[model samples]
Target: MADGRVDFSTPKGGSGASRAVFAHFTLRLDPDRLTRLRSPLAEIFDELAEEGPSASDDVMDVTLFTMLYGLRAGTES
Candidate 1:
């Protein structure tokens, strides 16, 4: 994504009696917002990690993960 190439999973709505979906997105955050976002997001992920093992098994695993990342080595500046 360093070269500005972002990725997302195609939204899916399964053929079922009720509506369901698995969606994903990538977004560009303004530089100034990064600091404000990191700590809260980390705490959320930590809480989820702690609660994960006790979650009931009737549903599949769902996750929300994010990171601060850099572009691939050969990408443009």
Candidate 2:
């Protein structure tokens, strides 16, 4: 590997199963909150999809999700 730890090309498992089976998950978001998030998510995807190849490299998904998560949490709380 480029990081000098392990080769990604190598097989890391046997049955190809993920160890993170719903661990440390958060509470379920109600249907109303989910409906509210849909439009914003679509807008984000649409904006990204229409961007040119030379677009800025500073865009971050975590920041966007964090903002949305905070807004949703505030409304529910």
Candidate 3:
């Protein structure tokens, strides 16, 4: 969000997530580092996507999971 806008017009393909998403913005964060970023990332998606009501931008409802933990790696899995 610091700069530039996301271009949802074109998409690429790969073996994993890159196959569907047109972009992959990395977060300099550990899965266990608690933050408010999770909400806006997965929550607002459905409101606009609407379960793929159209023939395009209709990807499956994949698990949009997020995690947060202490600064150091913990014993938790």
lDDT per model vs. reference: 0.57, 0.51, 0.49
The prediction achieving the highest lDDT against the true structure is 1
Q: Residue by residue across 6-74, what tens digits does model 1's lDDT show? A: 333333564433333344666577656766777787888889778766546644445455556433448
Off by over 4 Å in 2: 1-25, 55-77
Q: Order the numbered candidates by TM-score, best leading.
A: 1, 2, 3
Model 2 residue 65 CA deviation in Å: 12
Candidate 1 steric clashes: 0
The clash count for each model shown is 0, 0, 5
* TM-score-superior candidate, 1 or 3: 1
**lDDT (10s digit) by residue, model 2, range 1-77:** 37653323323555665422222435567778867877887887788668734446743232123333433445544
List of clashing residue pairs for candidate 1? none
TM value for model 3: 0.27
Q: What is the TM-score of each candidate against the true structure?
A: 0.40, 0.36, 0.27
Error of 3 at 37 (Å): 1.1
Candidate 3 off by > 4 Å: 1-34, 48-51, 55-77
Candidate 3 C-alpha error for residue 12, in Å: 19
Q: Which candidate is the best by TM-score?
A: 1
